[model samples]
Target: MTAVTDEGPGQVRGQVAGQGPGPERGRNPDEGSAPREGLPKDRGRPGRDWDDGLIARRAVSGAAPQEAPAAVPDDDVRPQVEAYVPSGSPLSPRLDALRELVGLSRARLDRTDLAEAGRVLDEAAARQRLSSRHTVVAIAGASGSGKSTLFNTLAGAQISEAGLRRPTTAAPIACSWTDGAAGLLDRLAIPGRLRRRPQQSGTGGDEALQGLVLVDLPDHDSAAAGHREQVDRVLALVDAVVWVVDPEKYADAALHERYLRPLAGHAEVTFVVLNQIDRLPGEAADQVLDDLRRLLDEDGMALGEHGEPGATVLSLSALTGDGVGELRELLGRFVQERTAATRRLSADVDAAAARLRPVYVAEGWPGLGERAREEFADRLAEAVGAAAAGQAAERAWRRNAGRACGTPWLRLWRWYESTRQPRGLDRTVFAAPPEEQLTARQRVEQAVRTVADDAADGLPGPWAQAVREAAVRGAQGLPEALDKLAARAGAEPGRDTDTDSDNGEPAEAAETAEPGGRTGAHRGRAAGRPPRPAWWPAAVLAQVAMTLLQIFGGLWLIGQIIGVLEPGLLTPALVMLAGIIGGPLVEWSCAAAARGPARRYGQEAERRLREAAAGCGRARVLDPVAAELVRYREVRERYVAVTEFSTTRG
Candidate 1:
């Protein structure tokens, strides 16, 4: 067993598994355990928390503590994300979760903030591939904390200089107990000259530490910025860490705030060592250790008490070798268990999740509503003038009905008037007020805006903007489409006649009968020929018969005045009266018969225009908005997958 010198690191020279000072030579250790630096002398002793911790690993690979170590020679540098994370491993979901997260951000989000996540995953994979047998633990501390001396004591050799300024050697020093750690040291960027072997040859009575690669990091509070940078870099790359703090600088704010606090989640892979505790006077070492625990708690770093689950805390003196055996035995189990890589990676994920959690949308998602869709359709119909078209249709029906059923004299009068002037239903039917037509374009724009807002509501900024853009794209030709829908004459779309047919488009302008249209289009219903009433022919016959009677009676009167034979004045006068009055009665009856049918046809025409307008809107604005909403929900699910891992992990 080996003990340490208080005044100089050189006192332990040439003692690399050779003749080092015994427990009797130095002041008694804080733990009063073995004389050796790492090997415990009080084996099988009661209240030995250090020995109890070495029971066995939690069986991560289903291998016992005595199971053979993995061979550490391979050529894998950069494996695919999935290839590294086997099917049933704890890290399997993390690959997809993080990959999906990054993919979504690049494709849809405004800024992908977690670039470190990639490095974390890559390092995890790279570590897994390198050496399963080895565990690389770094000894980190502020300048003048004697972490280098602690590093040397652990290796059983003066491999690192005690008081060397970090500016002279900005890079970390590495010592591997096993032979296959060259690649691992290379990955840490430790130059070949800085690499050391704990023994001159063989295991050298340190078989329990066979797979340990201990690193002496550059001082954390080094005035040379490069030294601090090196410290940060190596800490990120290492499997586990032992933070060395003397009693004076144990509660240093820079150390806690910059490193420990941020890395609190990694308590499992952490070792908080109260180094140089022999310098504490009286029972003050215990008090200092307790105060350090309090500071760690404030930093959100949990401490393991009575073998509970938390960070491994210990007080040791690299000089007097006090509690040094306890620290080494605990580390022996930590390295042999071989779970540092997994724990470090899991903590990295926890950290990544914390960084991204603030911006995550936790509320239930808002969807595209059916009510919004109907409102959008209604807007489009109004913009296209379906209401006004219905009125025009009714008027057109009346004009056509009058031609079929009116008295011959009245029909002749209407024909004469048509030659002079025609208003509302004059041949080309749809004649909405100019004011209503003027607002059609504005109404269409409003409809698009409203639907876009509804669809984009409650969405993230980039996704919301995407939905709006899709809506705008769909609305590009909508106004023209609506106009074409409503601007039809008295016919259905894409047909030659106002009636149903297989013929081509109308040849003449009047034949086309432009009616249902928006804004610039004729804003009214198509007034194609309306169906004739059943009694039209009968009404024509009766009117013609009355006219003949009037003619006969008038002739009879004229003959009587001319002194022709047998002329009765009462008969002629009654006949003439009957004919004139009957003509008026028949005309009135025909006008009443045409009214109901005319109104029905008008309504049907308007409905067709409205439906067309609605369909156009759905194709243009609503469908695209709906798709965007779907895409966003998909992105949201991906985000959940990414964050779910953090919550579920310890």
Candidate 2:
């Protein structure tokens, strides 16, 4: 019996009838005394058993080792092999996450990075569609690390230059295993001159690596700036990276600090190779590999998930081909999994999100308080001259009330005094003082600015600026609006009658007799009633009777003096005194009674005017300011939503 050998990675040797193990290689546990139907009398010393060496080789190569077949004879055994199974694409979900971020933040944030991320997604998607089966693995290393030699050895030909040129592999070289990778190569910007084809003999086990495209990149630490740039550019776009480091420079700080440290999260598709181990003894190679792993751990990289050191730490000599088969096997498995692209994209997203975490952090979202709102409103009222207007209305009402109900004898003097208009009005209603003349307009404008500034306090720069702008916009036409609103409010209440019309006629008194206004109008109108009291006629009749009595007394006294009647001087004089005193007392009493009505009318007028002015202030100033506050709140909510994702992700 002969042991089957694999020439290239994952290639299986041909099986002979009844002379070897099953089609799949590996020693069967029950093979010691099994009889076969074939006529070979004696199986030559049992074919080399698939032992620890083979299993260890596959394990170190990042491949899942298959179970050994049963030792049952060929008549009863039939091997089943699955050729290819594709891992579902992970790029779709990652792209969706990226797009979600862009959708929410583009309007509010600096989108330069987001735009670049979008480009990456688009390019990645297009590349995957054109060549889903292809796995782009780039060979990256610092200068003099045997990266090109490994690339050549992997290609099974002299594809990349491997000699003593300082900063070799100036341009990237792509080695494709199968046809149809031309479009993908173009997308990667690999020139036709740098492209090569690896030799392919048969399908079988080699079919697993059919779509693998290996790239030889320029030195990462190359003195030539362009060479380093080339390495960086290819590293960002490739599906996987195999970092080739020799035993001598395995722990170089330039490689770990600049590249590995930053790419810690990308360990899934990262490979750290300890190349040129032929220079070191077996034990020394092991020690070097250990030290290299320690350095990788310090850089915060987790290996093994995607064929990197965490899974299998490789120490091979690209010059002598020693231990090269293990690496090929790992590459074969990596290509078969077909997950490198998705893994690469996912890591990129993670890195992008990490960079964006700071901008999305939270302080707190407590909104404007009720106290602030009321304070602002009060300021606005003062600015609109609401208080002054109210006071003027009160004074004007009192003047009108005094003229209407004051003593009839003094009416002329009172009317003359009242005809002079109050300080700021021609009518009994309230209006805003002229905007330009009134200090209130400027005060109101300042109050608007103050309120806006207050609302924006403690907010982020962009959001705070937004709130301020909204407030400024709301206040743009406010001064003029206040004036118009005040005029309208003042006119709306007393439209029915021109009670305060400028005139000195008795008709003015008649007009004042109509119902007064405001909260106190009921009492005012009742008090201002000018109709004669029920007993007023009686008082007048009594006064007339007293006068007649005085006249009779006087006549009697005169007759007596002339010697026509008996003496009555005392009675005649007393009657005259009573008539005079009673008339004056009644007049004084009526005047006293009218005072209450006049005062009530004044109060009612003042109340109405104040209400009108306040209404105007609310409409023209407070309401618009409130609308701006509402807008700020809405934007705040949107901002919070946009930043919330970052918070949760971080």
Candidate 3:
């Protein structure tokens, strides 16, 4: 039974035997549907067999009609559409990989340039969500090709009156074997009154097609541009297609050049039907079928001609029902396997991946983080004048040692020079010139730029630009940070006591408050002002003894000159000579011993400065560059997964 309800002018809704009420009339189907920019607004449905205009009715089981159409977001609502595929299925990995590709591309690449990929994803997502239980197949052909006759023959009922009376199929019509396909038809923007179901008695042997939805598309070579537009749109969405051709138009240039050649990748879900074959006389039918097979092969469609797994071509006569049963049997088996949807989606993914292949790396990925880090640290170390600081420390140690152990006359001369210079010897006696400081700052900037360049090397344009931008963002305020470190570079490290352990090892120096460098060496400080050696006291005592000997000899000579005692020139002179020579010998020994400690002190100063600079570099540039590379790596991984899925399937 069927119920008709007329809600408004030119608006109609139908209620079938078991299917529920349709949506309210006068509402646009596209208000909640996916993008269909090129489709026409509905005046009336096409391809309906009924004398009455645009009405479809079907009887279904109580449990057949789904409560909701595949409820998925439209393209306007969600920028990247994700389709539902059951986990562990063959199509699941590829679907997930394609979704990830779209997302990553939006984030890394220009959004404006992804129109084609986004369209593919949007259409595929909508189709998958519309009905997992249903498979949509379209029958398409040129004008007067008897495509509608084949469509009606496969449907077991008349679908459209366009086969021989007219030169073009005005629009598309849909015939479904089961219910719950209203959402899918809505996706194609089919009117509610235009969908139909085959008679219940006629569906007896078609149990394999329980969820099949067949669409009769308009003439592919129709003179009316609208008919051809409708054909292309329907063909793009259906899971599989059966192209109907007659003997006259079997090898027509319009069909092969327009539709067959471009969709060669979709051979797995394709069928080529040679309709109206009974019109061929004698063996002409076989000859035309063989020739059609040759043309399909030339069009790059994988075929079952050599028993390979590919498109199935067959001869049929819809008027006489000669080969219609064979097509039905083959189509039933195809629907039963349920690989059509997956195969179609896989082919779409293949096409999208091919277009995007040029933007990614063709070979192995190499990282430059470790090498860049070391080079960056070295550069910073050089920028902060670490080597120069070390040299100053060495010179200071030598100068202090000379002061402590030099002859009295030389010490007096050094004191006079210090007084004239008016500068203390305990600290950094030399200041960096303005020009040197400017050069150091420039080197710091150069180090950052160098790391940024290295990070971006060999990357694709967008990723390389992203890495350089990240480096710049992280390297802000680096010069000021170095200046703070350099200010503390000359500070002296404190020592607890001027004593050695029981094993004769010097006590460790206290930790410096400076950040660029860690604690100095145990025996000496970064400032090179080490604790007095154990032998220093002995040298000082020996110098005191020598001075006393000289003093005693001088006093004796004075006493003799004053006539208070007898003069002994040889003994006194000998004692004075020994004192003079012994003092010089002590000074020479001390200078030689301090050389080793001075070198060690210089090394500590340089090491501390280098560490400070390295820490600054890491904070400002290296870590951020690494983070950018990590993000790029993730994007690359998604690309790899997408390519692998397509490659393995192909």
Each model's TM-score?
Answer: 0.71, 0.59, 0.69
* Candidate 3 total steric clashes: 2
Q: Write the per-residue lDDT of candidate 1 for residues 1-650, one digit (tens) a residue.
A: 00111122212211224434322121223311111233122221223223332212111222212212223222223321222233565565775677677666676553445455565556667776677677889998876676877887777776776543333335688888776676788888888777777642343677778778899987766655566656767777788899997655565555665567767888888899988666555676787688678878887887878876578888987876788889889998988877777667777776766655544463455567889888888888777767666666676567655555555777666556555653423434234455644466678888899989887777766777888999999989888777676555336632222321211111123422323223212432244545666778898899888888888888889989899938689999899888888887887787787788878877887788788888888888888888878876776676666556653332
Backbone clash count, each prediction separately: 12, 3, 2
Candidate lDDT scores, in order, read 0.65, 0.56, 0.63
**TM-score quality measure for candidate 1:** 0.71
Which ranges in model 1 have alpha carbons more than 4 Å from their true place? 1-86, 110-114, 164-169, 199-201, 204-208, 279-310, 353-363, 398-410, 422-439, 486-490, 493-521, 525-527, 530-603, 647-650
Write model 3 residue lDDT over 4-104, tens digit each, in one string: 11222111112123432233222233322221233223212223122222111211224222122222222111122223354555566766776777787
Error of 1 at 250 (Å): 4.1
Model 1, position 352, has a per-residue lDDT of: 63
| Per-model C-alpha RMSD | 13.4, 18.2, 13.8
lDDT of 2: 0.56
- Name the lDDT value of residue 125 in candidate 1: 70
List, residue by residue over 275-342, the lDDT tens digit for candidate 2.
87766643766766776777787778875745333434578988778888899998898888776676
Top candidate when judged by TM-score against the true structure: 1
RMSD, model 3, all Cα superposed?
A: 13.8
Off-target runs (Cα >4 Å) in candidate 3 are: 1-84, 93-107, 113-129, 141-146, 156-158, 161-167, 196-208, 219-229, 243-265, 272-326, 349-363, 422-438, 489-535, 539-565, 638-650
Give residue 573's error in model 3 in angstroms.
3.5
Please identify which of the two predictions, 2 or 3, would achieve the higher lDDT against the true structure.
3
- Cand. 2 TM to true fold: 0.59
